[model samples]
Target chain A: MELYIGGISQGKLTYVCNKKNISKDSDLICDGAGCTMEELLSKPFVNHFHLFIGRLLKEGGAIVTDGAIAPDGPKTDSDRHFLLKPGHAPDPEKIANVLAKDLIAENPSVVIICNEVGCGIVPVDRTDRLYRETVGRCLCRLAEYSQVVERIVCGLGMRLK
Target chain B: MIILITGGSGSGKSEYAENLAVKLGKRDLLYIATMIPRDGESMQRVARHQKRRKSEGFHTLECHTDLKRLPVHGFPTVLLECMSNLLANEMFSEEGIIKTRGNIPVVEEILEGIAYLDRLCEHVIIVSNEVFSDNGSPYAETAGYIKLLGEINCRIAGLASCVYEVVCGIPVCQKGSGIL
Candidate 1:
């Protein structure tokens, strides 16, 4: 099952799940706040979790960090690491790869939280357009892999599975 | 064979289609319905449709948007109940309005998808509403959307092996050489 946490706002993750009566055992939280990954991992039942911190992290299962940082880190070379900076979109294939790896390795009940950035008029700015397109493609990929999918609107959940 | 049954609002398109589907005596009758209950009236409409389909014993699939994910294979007969709601869904969906620039694509993607259904299924029946007959409304967006629907209807008619326009619960064959 795939739960898509959307909207420009944050902190609705726990509230929405509680409202739906869905347990938080295998939840995978991905958000802009660099701290969400750590918080989710703190839960006793969470088997594995990942975060895409734009900056390099010395530790983590899969590190999607800034490319400008030096290659030397505590992480092994083959530990599903990515270096993508802020204001830049990660490659769809690479994101899909990480998701696939996590699905196989972690094998936890997964929920993904992402920003809803494509509900309005097209942005006149190129960067904004590119970001929206990238996010859209990423969501599509997630949907392809997901057994069930939902989109939250006005804090109400609509199942699109 | 691909057949399209279309009519204006309150013209009983759903009723006619359901009766035809039951008469066909096919178990794999796929009903691709597109309606969201955003208000009391819409909710009532949905309940009414549900009751009608339940009485008819037709298998239904609710697709509010994202027609790209529609299963193309394994169904004997597919009935896409309406296209207007699908268009509205694409209009209001995430990044939908922006992607279409408020103008629904007049190109062949929609037609191509329908053709794909043709190749995948033994029989395909599409249901649509006739919105062009009424010229009273002055809303530019509504008018533009109707024009687009007209274009889409024309295209579907061109490709459809049978085209029937339902008026007052009567089916009138408008195109192709077959009867339904």
Candidate 2:
């Protein structure tokens, strides 16, 4: 599996397409956004991991997102980590072992793209902080098993592996 | 060669800079740690960083603010751990005063610091943060902080031989390659 990561609008998808020589073929595209966990795990491309987490938060236990930003919502102590890992996202170990294992086995060249959102100050909201940590952990998990981990900046790809 | 390595938090900019310095430094290798740990979180953070660079054979000189603390000679190569903290230390007074709340003065001080480093070492590698790649305006003070970091990044990048922005632990070159 090849990991292509950067901030939003850093040309990750275009770089992947050009590098993979994948042109004019929607058949190769696997829409992973908003898919059920089973479906998303089955697909080759896992897009919108952040949104997936959001959807999971709304659907799961111990995760109550009054949403990403809440200026008027009353603050509460319920925001702190109730468990070691929030129930919002899928079990990272399972995802790494099951989905990631399957991906590496079946797909010869899988392009994993994610935006870098952990740069700024830690968010005031618990959900936002959890979201940032989740994405970061997910990326690290994926990169560990990936053959190539590339970070794109200003349309330049660096082979970090 | 002067190199600027920048990225988002947890993006491995420091690690990349260390690798490059290890690959290049043959003489007096200096690791300029700019962090001043004043709290538990910060002490833990600095400890983690120190652990990572433990076996990398670095002579860490904690120059929290003043760049002149670095030696003027003998150090062939110096890797400045980060610029963000240095800016905060220099821009803010101990009485909770903030100097150069504007961009020009902060940028000038940063550039002057860089020039000092340039003269001190034969080669310098600076690790900075990518502060402009975020959404929405932060609080006014934070927004001002980000603006200062962005300005310093631009001018120093223009002066460096190579500029790398590491995203997700990968180093992507943005300017001239330091390696021949």
Candidate 3:
């Protein structure tokens, strides 16, 4: 089954990925990075995973990881892991299609990291509002593809298995 | 009251804001001008704005990048003319240059300062140019700055009770009714 992890805290994901034996693979296709969607899709890979931290992940065909922001506290763990992502919108689907093709072709268990972009007040600017909507749609698409979904609040993880 | 007026270059936002301040009969209007006297044309623009405000007898506060240090004497209206320029000044400032990429602490500090000013003022009007309008792809740094500026502008606009989008010298208020 595909596993997705996301949250606003980078440290948490790094820790989890390390524990789960997921590190930067030369074969990994990372469309969520600043690279163009075309570049990510074109890259050859067996299993594709997208990692999103403080930002939104809009690319398709992968399980989504939830990386919501942490609430007020020291670096210590708490129950706020289910915090939502920050930001307004998602990247275009055309870009996401590139990444989706790679993940589906390989049929490997793909994990995605995405920020919950809708946890804040709605923005007044059109572009800002559009961003939030885009991110939300991206997450929805990712959830549709995933066999399981999970949310992290504070430091606790609840699996939608 | 505190208002921030921001817009892209040549959007005529500053001119509209000047007119609005006058219509409000705020003789002691605190115009927090951000543009510096860089070149002759820029100098002239600053002078013209100063002259127009002076002719109408409006008080002005000229600040470079240090909004935190500006004296806040409880002005009824404070107009933060343009945030992009302020951000540019702060980002390229001697100390600002030392901060590395993705190090958003400085920008956060500035946002916090703006939020503080907004809370302290009675009635604030903010003006900002829409930098995302029809411009082709910009350099990476420029694009990053614009995105960051847009984020800050949206946050501030969210707090504003009134928001206006000035198009072709016309003010379209997106929120709140009544003219300034």
Candidate 3 ranges with C-alpha deviation above 4 Å: A1-161, B1-8, B95-106, B135-138
After superposition, candidate 1 runs with Cα above 4 Å error:
A1-161, B95-107, B177-180
Model 2 / residue A151 / CA error / Å: 7.2
**Residue B18 C-alpha lDDT in model 3:** 77
Error of 1 at B65 (Å): 2.6
DockQ of predicted model 2:
0.22
Write down the worst ten-residue block by lDDT for model 2 chain B: B95-104
Model 1 fnat value: 0.00
Evaluated against the true structure, the overall lDDT of model 2 is 0.66
lDDT of 1 by residue, A1-161 (tens): 35454454444455456755765443433333343443432322221121232222324234434322222332555443332334343343344344444443343345555554443333444434434433444454555566755555566665555
RMSD vs true structure, all candidates? 16.9, 7.5, 18.7
Every model's TM-score: 0.49, 0.69, 0.48
Candidates sorted by lDDT, best first:
2, 1, 3
Better of 1 and 3 by lDDT: 1
In CAPRI terms, model 1 is classed as incorrect
- In CAPRI terms, model 3 is classed as incorrect
Worst 10 residues of 3 chain A by lDDT: A65-74
How would you encode candidate 2's per-residue C-alpha lDDT over A75-131 as one tens digit per residue? 444532322234333232232234344445555365676777777755666556555
